[model samples]
Target: MVFSNNDEGLINKKLPKELLLRIFSFLDIVTLCRCAQISKAWNILALDGSNWQRIDLFNFQTDVEGRVVENISKRCGGFLRKLSLRGCIGVGDSSLKTFAQNCRNIEHLNLNGCTKITDSTCYSLSRFCSKLKHLDLTSCVSITNSSLKGISEGCRHLEYLNLSWCDQITKDGVEALVRGCRGLRALLLRGCTQLEDEALKHIQNYCHELVSLNLQSCSRVTDDGVVQLCRGCPRLQALCLSGCGSLTDASLTALALNCPRLQILEAARCSHLTDAGFTLLARNCHDLEKMDLEECILITDRTLTQLSIHCPKLQALVSQLLVVDLPLRDERCPATLPHYRRNLLSGRVSSIILGFRGLLVGLTWEVENLRVTVFVFGCEPNTGTQVLTQIHGQPVE
Candidate 1:
């Protein structure tokens, strides 16, 4: 029953269309919906062409259909810059065609779970909207190489594309994308098991601007494939090779040597990697901030010490070091002895304390089952933990 400034409604008609549009822009989606019910004038302004620039119909996915999107697109009058239909399962090729026809100015479109649509939508985009910048086809199994070819031929301005879990796609599809979209920056091919070295090789050959690549669960991508990928794409920053069981020292070596801007690397479940692979990474990749080495059974204390000495900014170390059998030669022993000691007494890894080499000289880090605190070198008895703790700052436990 209530509305914005009831007295101002009387003079709202006198306001210029541009000013009215600007004023309507300040209202949130909920407020605009309420205003639409107030009167005909308010309704017209509420659904104005300028007001529909970014339509996020993801929340209304369960309730809305193609007609809703069509209506919004018509109201937008080709100014819909960003549209996200994240889980609108009912949307199909016809709905996308209608959207493409009306919202020609749309630059970013997210149809992550729109399963009913196929390559027809891609063809529609190629025919109608050529300037699309971002597209998410996650889990859209209906699409094939034809759609990728269509996108490659038309969407030349495409920058970010997510084909994650689209197992139907092959090397040819991505090859087309690489050839068409030169400025492509971020590409996610997670779970694209059908693709092998050929896909990455082609991308490295053409898509020079690529920065972040996620090939998690890509079983066929061997160390040779990754070596080639790293050799070409030098500016790569984030790479996720989770579930890539075949990766070894060769892949890590290539990444360390080539990708100077590398920051995040998720190598979880890469069971073949050992201490040598990580040691090479630490020695070369000094800028590494986060690294996931979970399930790497062969790694020990040397790798952790290398990371601590090399990567000054290393923040996260996703490793199974603490949970595994606490071996004396393990990397966690030297790098995080204080943590292990704390956890041994308490439930969680308390702070063991370490600064001067692997052995902190004070804590009883298990010597033949008996607790024997060893004081080696100039470290007196009580000052060992204090001196090191002061140097390393507060306790990490």
Candidate 2:
């Protein structure tokens, strides 16, 4: 490209090499690609490894082929820190082999929805990319225990992993993972149906640093599995047992007795859970914030009242088809009601989804030092079945 007397490509000629690279770092991937086409000098500056440190190819997932990933890996090389190739169906093990070899310093990699890749891709990652920390392999159906073995062999610094919907994963794979990667803090095994109680045992024994675990839909896990898990992982804060039909109240009892720092608990669809389990939990775990008791048929208003009285830090409570009861009388209401109502009025309790068969009928009363405003949702105005919907000091319609 010829520059006129007024232009003279003065900017590129006058600027230092460091300043030119610094300027190119501000451009996005599309703009960088466009800039690379201007001239030889601009092409070298635009394709510099430092400028391509973090690349997210999710926008071009459908159009991106394996060659694009390989070329990017080569260009970025040791300078690349993060790369996301999510939903790129065309990316296979062969391209990933080159990527892992070239970009060995890559820290965070997302291969989610890349269906064409198999265990060979994991093998490449394990051979290189030793500094890998976070990985999202969600919906990678082709992955099996062999892939877990590869990840366990390497990726020791891995802290967060999402293996959601990977159907082939079993107890053996989980054991191998936790045995090697004991530093794992969060593991999402949602929808991995093949996992049984043995896998939980392995996680309890090996992964002691685990704080967050999602066992959603792992139907084979019984109360015994949860007991072992809670006994071992005392640092557990967030636990999801949604759709695990085999779990009973014993699991909740185990959690309450062991995990004192328990904050978020999701036991939706666990039919055997009663108010007895939750009453004990609320008394023991005062830091509880979010509770999802949807589809728990056995629990009544007793559970709701107990949680409101004891768990002062409670924010979101999702109890669909359950009655909400908050006694207003001076003798009946506990001293903690004032503190709970204060937290509610101060906007700490942002969401309280209590579903009952009724319409909102306003009611306000003074119980001890607290002036509480309750929105009672009852089937009929005359009926005595009053369900407390909110406690925001002002009437909620």
Candidate 3:
């Protein structure tokens, strides 16, 4: 068949330089570099500073010295907007400093899993990337309160900050961050066990614009701290308290009452939480889109059903509560069963199902008549009973 003019143009060898460069942007650095060697035009566009805005040198092996980063930054010129060096074991403080100095326009920087990065590197980043708005230092073990001081002093425009698993950061560092970066909207301190009530209190006091806060694994934070946070940041859309062992039902209840705009809440591993906490969430926070109650032993079908009824927008849920125990009257029961099944099939659900035998052993008056069996499965197509199964005397698959 004869091709139309448009089709001919598509198959034409000659293409506009801008279009070719735009296409090159989608290619990986290695592939782009290889294409650059094919022709002069490709080389010009590939090496152009405009196309080098986001540099992902993750896992790129090089010498421990600053030569690799320095060379890359120098070659990319000053147009680098985002620099992600995650899992780059070869890079140290010297290399990071070199990049920071050259890429002053960088807005998003991820040094996650970079264990070699010390406070000195973070300090250098604050000094160099004054315009940086997003910084992810997750798993950067060397960063301390001193680094926060530097970050607060320099990166005042920061909007998003993730220091998850940074064990060194204490209340002092968090306070400094809150005091310095008033514009910060999202803060993830998951696994920062050293963080306490004082740090969250500072966030509530200074970071009024905060939209998302994650304090998962921060065992030191108590109900008082969460109460303070909910009372202060009313506009908060997302709040994560997974593994925060000290948090009780009262804190969640207060949060539900206070944070009406809360869209996402993750209270996984919060052993202190009970049905009362979920009831509070159901009564309020109707806009919730995501909730995680994994390992919350106190949560039953009753709370899950209540959450489904209240939070129609809920799209994600991670919980240990059995679907079979939830009252069928709950509108969310059908939806939740499917979600649970999907998570189970995908291996995303981390909590183990406590056997009926274990429950029977734990209960004082439980007899043979008590039917308790937990089946982990994704929701079947068009069938709401994704979590249902018949237990017989003999084991059957």
Candidate 4:
């Protein structure tokens, strides 16, 4: 287009090539498509290799087809680092294979909920994307032990692998991964229904560098499996045995003695766990920060007291206390209050924001025919001169 001195086009052309490309780089993939259609200069700037470091197809329309994926992959070439194709059901094994072949430098790949992909796609990914480190295959139901063969052989650098709800994989595949990918740090096998003690034993035997292990909903994993696994994985920082109801105090006792580095442990719905096991954990695992023991009927206030005293790092506790719904009624019960140690700035401790004194009150509620009293401790749960005495499922006025 012809332009005078005041023309916007004339002014934009006067800008340096570096400045033009830098401006184009800020545009997202969809916006870049529009930029490419504007003019020849903008088209060249949009396709520049630096502008395509990350391609997340989840940002685009649901109908992103195989040709679109192939074109994007070709444009990216070897520059792609992070590619998220989460829920991109229109594209499958063929398009993903094309991507894996071109983007060799890819590190993080999120293919969560891509139902059309099978073991062949995983094989292609392993053969081509050798630099792959993080992979999320959550809900890829077609994925089986055959996929592990590809991952085990080539994806040696893989550290974080999430196979959550990929129910097709079994003990054989899991065991192969543990043995082959010794560098595996975080492996999530939640809802792999066929997995049992056999896979846990394999993990215990081989996966030593593991820090986070999620065996939640693996109903077959019992206390024996946990005992064996904890004995091997001493560096475990986070462990989720949620819904593993078969586990007893034996598992907790083993973890307390073995996993001193354990910080976060979630045993939600583990009805068999008792105070004896949790107390052992609190006294031993000084680095413990968060613990979930909901539905563990045997766990009482004693464990809470022990955690408050022994675990200095404990910030969040999910014991039965968090679930206790104090019904609104006129009932008085003497609560044996735990002396909560507060950070002492002066000789006396105060919850008051200002340097003044405040009134202290106690709370009493009935649960299971037993009246329990809770002496209010910690920062006052009030907002702008309001007091909240009892909080049920919903907030109180």
On lDDT, the candidate that comes out on top is 2
lDDT of each: 0.77, 0.82, 0.75, 0.75
Candidate 3 stretches greater than 4 Å from native: 1-23, 39-42, 59-65, 326-397
Candidate 4 local Cα displacement, residue 173, angstroms: 0.5
Q: In candidate 3, what are the lDDT values of residues 1-397, reduced to their tens digit?
A: 7655456444224787778777878887788779779656567877777777887876474433457677778877678888887777667898788888888988998888878889999888888999999999999888899999999999999999999999999999988988999999999998888889989899999988989999988999999999998888989999988888888988988888888999888888888899888888877988887777778887776775676567666666666643433223334444533433332332222333321211210101111332223343333224343344333343211
Off by over 4 Å in 2: 1-9, 326-397
**Which candidate, 2 or 3, has the higher lDDT?**
2
The candidate 4 region of ten consecutive residues with least summed lDDT is: 338-347
TM-score of each: 0.81, 0.81, 0.78, 0.80
List CA RMSD, all candidates: 7.4, 8.9, 8.5, 8.1
**lDDT, candidate 1, 331-368, per-residue tens:** 32345445535434432221122223333323232322
Q: Name the best candidate (by TM-score).
A: 1
Select the stronger candidate by TM-score from 3 and 4. 4
Put down candidate 4 lDDT per residue, 34-76, tens digits, no spaces: 9888667778888887788887888663978888878878988
For candidate 4, the TM-score is: 0.80
What's model 3's overall lDDT? 0.75
- Please report how far candidate 3 places residue 80 from its true position, in Å: 0.8
